[model samples]
Target: MNDYENMSDEQLVQLSLEDQDCFYYLMKRYDIKILRYIKRLTTISQEEAEDIIQEVFIKVYRNLNGFNRKLKFSSWIYRIAHNEIINQYRKTKLRLAMIPSNIEDQANLIDSINDTIEINGAYENLEKDERVRKALAELPDKYREILVLRYLEDKSYDEISDILRKPPGTVATQINRAKTSFKKIAGRHQLNTGIVK
Candidate 1:
């Protein structure tokens, strides 16, 4: 068994500085995560997502020394990924798709407006998943990004703050506002908001 497998990110980073091979461990650790993140944030196919992941890791490698130890390594990596995604968007004007895209079982979206939008069986028959996807697609980039980070990626407020470079308070505010906007969109779709009577 290789002790490298158990080494912390910081440890791997230090070792990587001494031995280029150690950097591969860091890339292995985050390859899938970065790929999924890119896929979620862009409508690009898996092939394109893979290419983006390569670019993200390359940037990570080049800027490895610039990494801020004060932040969670994962957060810093994600910030890099986020910036790369934005750059691609600027060039192509692409947008993110819903992640963990189980419309049928989307707990976060459902739970957000579950109070006001009761999902009765009759309403549930109205293709709620498609409706939710549409509503999410309609959301502005900032709102969607927060929801994805908090819900899909399952990141903590502090982690989100680190990645977005926003205060936790601001992240919370954005989430609340995103939920409110989502509720309005869901209502418009008539996904059985119970108020459609």
Candidate 2:
């Protein structure tokens, strides 16, 4: 074990400044978690998600000196990842809108998956997963952001508020509302698919 938890964030910052390898250690610790979080937020292709991950890390490396020790390192990195994904989404949406609809098929899209195994002779969960992802993608960005941050990223309301620069009470209400909205959307999708009676 690297005992990274034992080292203070300030110490890590100092070490990262002096040694590039030390910075790589921080990236190794958080990259996968951040990538997974980003994957749920946007429907970008896997290759594009990989590129965004690299870009987020590069931005983190360049801005490491400005990081404050008061905030947890994970919070700081996730904020960066969130910003990068949103930026990429805007760019992609603009680009796609400019292209002819028929030619948009050239874009490499990654199919999102949602899978869970059950032991009670239940129907395969793949259908449920697909419905959820479709419903989630249809939500407004504000609702989707709160949902992913709360459910998928497993971030506390305070952490999410800090990351999003929102009030804690607002975050809580947004999450509550988002859950209802998501359930409605998922229900509608299930009905449309003949998966629910």
Candidate 3:
């Protein structure tokens, strides 16, 4: 497979520390996966997602010296990404608070509609995809992250647990809970559209 896959973590880390190209290679391996995770969490404009992705990578690169070999590299990068997204969300909240109440609501509503439309267009059938995306959007971050990593990203429970720093049993339980929540939201949406269960 990939060079990194064959190399020991210690070797990769050593290479990354010594060479900028090695760091770039590491970023190339993980960037899209991390970006997809961030996008699902933020549900914001693409520009905002790009900005956060840069911030996350920067943090990861700068902090490489401190990385522990005991942890999986993917987990470490995702942890950085998760923190960056939370920071961005807080910043967004403060900015929204500074705006007029009516304007803030309207802006959020428009953004929601745009997100819905974008997600809808990605699927072959608009209504079902919209329902699914809306359901996903409703999930709490903890549940949503696990669900997306498990189902959408096709990661095993062990991988998800590592990424989230949770036990495998906890990841399994959270995924089940998230699926139940998603089904409820989907069922309600389908009923509203006259789609029979």
Predicted model with the maximum lDDT: 1
Best candidate, TM-score: 1
Task: Judging by lDDT, tell me the better candidate of 2 and 3.
Answer: 2
- Per-model TM-score, in order, reads 0.85, 0.70, 0.67
lDDT of candidate model 2 versus the reference: 0.64
Residue lDDT tens for model 2, 1-197: 26755676567778889988787667777878887766666555668779999999999999998887778788888889888877887776612111112112111110111211111223346655445556655667787667557655668988998788789999988876765665567567752322110
Clashing pairs in 1: none
Which order, best to worst by lDDT? 1, 2, 3
Candidate 2 C-alpha error for residue 63, in Å: 1.4
Report the number of clashing residue pairs per model. 0, 0, 0
Off by over 4 Å in 3: 1-10, 94-130, 190-197
Ranking of all predicted structures according to TM-score, beginning with the best and ending with the worst: 1, 2, 3
| lDDT for each residue of candidate 3 in 30-89, tens digit (9 for 90 to 100) | 778877767655556667768888998889889989987787787778778877877877
lDDT of 3 at 163: 72
Report the C-alpha lDDT of model 1 over 1-197, residue by residue, as the tens digit.
Answer: 28999889998888888888889999999998888777666778888788789999999988889989998899999999999998888887765665334443255544544543455445453377667667767788788788778766779999999999999999988888877787677778765444321
